[model samples]
Target: MDVVVIGQIARDLAVRVDEVPGPGAAVAVRERIEVLGGKGANQAVALAQLGCRPALVGVVGDDRHADEVLARAVADGIDTRAVVRCPGTRTGLIIDVVDGGGRWRYLQDLPEAVLLTAADVAAAAPAFTTADAVVVQLQQPLPAVCAAADRGRRAGATVVLDGAPPDPGARSDLLARCDVLRADDSEAGLWADAEIGSALDALRVARELRARGPRMVVLGAGSEGNVVVWPDGEAVIPLGDADVVDTTGGGDAFTAGIVAALHEGPEAAARYGSAAAVLTVSHTGGRPNLSREEVAHRARP
Candidate 1:
């Protein structure tokens, strides 16, 4: 993959339970399903589906699940050489609960998931150096992610940052290093200090964020579509409606699609990205990422 992704790779244990649990209340549920997940892994898969070979850098436990993860990555055509095997830890796993209304909730206990060390980051630098773009998510330690982004920039690659799993304390220096910034509407509010209530508001918020560092900012509004704000101006990327299945990974798919479309042009990038995201929300988990042909078909006028 020409895109290098740095962050967490984990397994998700999802269940359909009753309403959200209160302080000390117990809720009963139905069934549970375990799937390979983690935002970084999801984005890498999404990027691969878009015809970009993605290289993922992260630490996974030397367990069966870890082996499966590595195998899956290779099978999906993602580079697996940079994945570190932490000898004693188990693979990171998240507990996700969905209610009758399809409201999703998460509880993460990443015992086996460890942030990449400086040495680990150094080992993966070469991959970023040769890639067209290095993609980053907040699943890894801030310092590690910063280092990777810096390395990618030094290597003359576009540093795309997706600042989700929102952190209130992210450093401005790192923000300054980003070239393309993507975030959800709520995250746009946290960065711009404005309520991104509508698509126009979200575009404004993205423009505001551009002043801080990134040359371009994209605000993902889920079913509302997306907005791209740059130094020149802003435009809303339209999307066709679909029966939403799972909201998870829609934004990641969007990020992946945009990165893939970077090889084309901005307009194509935005349209393909919107299509990928809309299609993602129509499926289950983060798998079944839309291929370039699928994205192209959806993006057609």
Candidate 2:
């Protein structure tokens, strides 16, 4: 009940292939599956599964997938009362391909996802205003993310931004509103205009982003784990060894972990958050549906 997620929601079609296509060469597929995805939805599901109550604010079309998405959100313990049903426009969609090595490529169609108007934001104002923290992603328009962050901050909630797709031209106002800024290595590298080849490089980028305003910067270092940088000091929480399945939602899970930890305190959250992410990699799909007890059991021992 303390966390609010605002942004686009889409259904993901994930396919696992034996090899990737190289310059006009097509490859054979080993297997395929579809699931609900999108950073907003994924993170919301992650929060709920991690034992944090999360409410989602977004727009979905009047389609079967939309129905399924909403139903799934409810089943996942996410509040969908703020979700809108836009007519005519199709529910957002994503086609993701994962190679044998876990490399991924995705093509998304998000027309209806952009339908979260200012009115939609107004409807969710109460949730944002009352929550302890607000979670947002870049899948939606920059303006919406900004407005949501501003509203949440004004309401006395900690605003957390998951800067995905690595938008370097991100709005400064939005950056200033964020309490925690989370992104992967590639995104960090893009923002810093330098390659994040190592933890030190990631730390440098985190520092650069922190200069913009966020109280904390978390650079997701893939298998190398994550680096949490603050004004006082920096902490590197290495990923525990886990078998790789699909890496799509691992970062979202990590974000959920960080938020949950923040619900406690920074130091406690970092260790638990690190465990949540590592456990996610050990599971399949984008969002791992594990309870807090399960996460703690795996994370601690």
Candidate 3:
């Protein structure tokens, strides 16, 4: 499938620590690595790895980091022709601190990414219109995200929104434009007006999010699996056990899987997403070790 991913592109600096330090305490870093990451880029790469041949539409700086990010995307087989180069700005950057438990905390510098404007979205109209699906992350400016979603919908493509808007008030309009909406526990809580730590909470969040406007809603609760709600019905798809090494891009990987299997029903697509996420978390970086064949094999009952 030809999918278009719109959002942030950044270089990720990752550090491994035994534990996260307290406010005043310092901790030893066990290891450090840098890789291509950002919600948008990660999902695009995941789609490419899954044999979707995705096109990326987002902004980056004129800096060398931008070159690295774009190079990696192209190497992974993503079409980067729609990636904008903004002068006088640095590419987005993210620092991920992973603890022994495989959980992570992120610090982001996204000045350039958030600067993506309606003009940028307008420039990518060809990509949006021709794509079978368009996946948008909330990392970009609200206007740009909305514009891209609107364009994709008008083009008769399936629009999948990857996260909720930072402002709760603007979420309804965004949801209404998207065919599918996927969110992690925290984002689900923001939209559902309830905490999302447990399975029940995830289901409630999915139901509430569905009520907002999306034709389908997917709420992912790490380890608890995913709750999928669509027009027909809802289902809780459980994921298999994984040896998690990092959790940084698991959500994005899940999003890619969903887009790849969208022709299937919501429950089946969520199962494919869960399988993709299991492979991602088992690796150290945002990139997954498995290919489309491997993911399909794992998804099989």
Each candidate structure's TM-score, on Cα atoms with residue i matched to residue i, is 0.89, 0.88, 0.92
Cα RMSD (Å) between model 3 and the true structure?
2.2
Would you give me the overall lDDT of model 1? 0.78
Q: How many residue pairs of model 1 clash at the backbone? A: 3
Model 2 pairs in collision: none
Q: What tens-digit string does per-residue lDDT give for candidate 1 at 129-247?
A: 68889988865676677888888899889999886533567646767889988887777777776667788788767767788898888886644777887777677886667677667
lDDT of 3 by residue, 1-301 (tens): 8999997888989898999998999999898988888888899888888878799988899899999989988998889999999988899889988999988888989884446788999998878767899898986778888999999989889999987685677888888889999988888877777678888889877777788788899987756778899988988878777898898888999999999988877888888898999899986767665587778777775
- Judged by TM-score, which candidate is best? 3
lDDT of all predictions: 0.78, 0.78, 0.85
TM-score of 3: 0.92
Worst 10 residues of 3 by lDDT: 283-292
Residue pairs with backbone overlap in model 3: none
For model 2, residues 1-301, the per-residue Cα lDDT tens digits are 4799987688878888887889989888787767777778888888887777899998888889999988888988898888888877789898878878878887878884445766788777778757998988765666677788888889888888886532456646667888988888877765677777888778887888788898888886655777888888887777777787777777778788889878555545666776777777664457566578867766562
